[model samples]
Target: MDRHAPSTRCAVITPQLSKRAARAGSDRRSPEARLEEAVGLAAAIDLDVVFKGLVLLSEVKPATYLGSGKVEEIAGIVQAEEVGLVFVDAALSPVQQRNLEKAWSAKVVDRTALILEIFGSRARTKEGTLQVELAHLNYQRSRLVRSWTHLERQRGGFGFLGGPGETQIEADRRQIGERILRIERDLEQVKRTRALHRTSRKRVPYPVAALVGYTNAGKSTLFNRLTRAEVMAQDLLFATLDPTLRAVDLPHGTRVILSDTVGFISELPTQLVAAFRATLEEVIEADVILHVRDISHPDTEAQAADVRDVLTELGVDPEAGGRVVEVWNKIDLLPEDERDRMVNTAARADATDRPTLVSALTGEGADGLLDRIESLITAGRVMLTVTLPAEDGEGLGWLYRIGEVMEREIGEDGLMRASLRILPERVDLVKRRFGAAQVRTEV
Candidate 1:
């Protein structure tokens, strides 16, 4: 039978681990919560979740990952419920996945594959498409074509999740290898283009602040609230896959580039992390990173820990203080007493570790969020007093464009005295244009 098309009817199973799964003990949420997320993942791709369950594993079985009796139980459910697809909410080995398919007589997808499916459907940009395709190819390469011996029909080159350009994927191993190479090469150029864009933005003196958090934690909502751009913000997992950037003026005079990026989830696939590193360069280079959280969720703490893990894997230290600001979002869903408690907790903490509670949907506490972001960006700046000849318009223009001009006046002696708050990195340029003695920090 050909399983090239996407399956509409699906069953989601969350396997609670008693042992290691890459970073064991990393996922500490209740199994019920995990099952809900798995169902949501299926929903993200428009799959109807007809069945969902929790499988307690004392030790993961090598053949099926589930016990033989449990496997038999699900097999009966598959036939009764007419499930065309089974989404196992854990990483399954090639052999394990094949065995499960044989037992259930349904297309079986592991957690990684389900997440990839969601990403494949959500990708809206060329760069996002490249990253998703690269990740899909990388993942599919490991599931050798030899595993599909029972299928009499010819298979497509695409991974488990079938989307656009499905016919273009060749079944030959060599062709898949070639496609991977081509995608990687294209991604390199995309990375270079992104770097050039960052360089250009640096010239304008606008600091980049990226939004990151657990999937569906209201990041895109907050981003839209701040930037006034209508990027996709829905109550779905991985709703916005493409990274979007918009400029917003803070409560203060400074402006910043607010980037809305793909949200993080617990046990994010390694293939995706390696493939999408190019797109996450913005978060790595951002001057301030807003770690948004759905404070009203029952599993909020677990979700926060998951986001921090992904950040650490990306070489960002979430606890390094000032750079990563925790934005407690979706407080509009919380009770009044709980909201007040969170506000008090945030108020008691120091600046570096404090969180800014806000309801992105209601426009509550937006000004405070902007102020916090501006303060962190401004903290790295130095106040400089520069004196240049009034006749030299070019030099005067550079200072105004490169820094925030707080005060300016023309001296009686054909000289312009201006005090500005300039980023620390740009201080040398000011000293180079004008004499070192003419530049002083009055404030």
Candidate 2:
């Protein structure tokens, strides 16, 4: 479904080095894949890519980023195609963006701007809107450099030289500054509210499992499958922007809060990340994190690394024991042999929390995933057997709300024997509420 109302005809330009420096790891993706990904990013914002090309650069020009001849060549294509926008699939300085726009006679947006535009459009909630606006303003602040000589002119100067754009620029800067301050204040309140919500959850605490992955890696799809809640699971990039929390039941009857967060991407702008820190706090507070991966993609490993980098920035350790479980998803699209290999690979791992192979589309191998999640969420939990009078409905209700009731039986003596799985932090409280003599705890 198209969420954006306006669509602009644009040209995509991906500039790469003719001879690139060797880098470590498994990120040796072809330029064609990179170009395709850039095109997808453009399409994410409803931009019609009329002309696209990969330009090889021996060296980057400071003023225009691309060579003079290459700039002229692209200019010719932009005019011929009547493109209203040019998307450079690389970082561009303010000067380069301005110069390129002047040469092409069209608006120039870099990869960061394209992603920000998608976020600006997809943000639904008040907090999401504030975060996007804060990031947008921060990004625009850097673009306020004096490009035109007229814009550098001062009012009431010695030489009586002042440009109208300069005054407008100053006014815009003031307005943006005020807006940023207001957003910062609003975000502070949002952060505190989230913290309060977390505190409240602790009272009846259900473990939280957060879903994180690369853009279009089926995170939303897996979230929908597990929670059975429709949350805009689509093939499009950034389909899920606002964070959603739903209570899901595990195989063993334990309930957990499943959080579906916005997808991460390669080279995510630091400004955006900083602005969304409040939203990402959910991941930090999660008891278990499900790192969903599109194993069918050719660049899956690289995408995993990008996701890990973002998680690291958010203070979630992916490699630490019981911190994050890797979910190898989208196996339905893989060939039979590949799927078998993936299953065998998962089975071979000896780690406590090994990767799980599942197809969220067809509900394949989902039970195993749920079992693993249950184990992870209750890793340090204590199992208790409490004996209380069968007539004590209040005590039984409290136990059911705070902990998972594994089993319950009523004895002939009119006493209830209930088994429970509870967090260690609440063990003392549970014992205090119901006499310690009535509870037996096991690790």
Could you give candidate 2's per-residue lDDT for residues 330-358 as a string of tens digits?
99999999888888888888776579888
Question: Which tens-of-lDDT digit does each residue in 1-443 have in candidate 1?
Answer: 12476657999988886655424654578778888988898888888799999887778898889999999999999999999999999999888999999999999999889889889888888999999999998898887544445432444446784432333333445687999999999999999999999998998778999999999999999999999999999999999899999999887678899999999988889999999888789999999999999999999999999989888988999997889999999999989899889989999999789999999999998999999998999996899999988787888788878998777789888788988889788888889889799999756
> Candidate 2 has what TM-score?
0.93
Question: What lDDT does model 1 reach?
Answer: 0.88
Candidate 2, position 243, lDDT: 95
Model 2 error, position 1 (Å): 12
Deviation from native of the Cα of residue 179 in model 2, angstroms: 0.7
Q: Which 10-residue window in model 1 sums to the lowest lDDT? A: 162-171
The local distance difference test score of model 2 is: 0.87
The TM-scores, one per candidate, come to 0.88, 0.93
Please name the candidate that would achieve the greatest TM-score relative to the true structure.
2
Q: Quote the positional error of residue 172 for candidate 1 in Å.
A: 2.6
Clash pairs, model 1 backbone: none
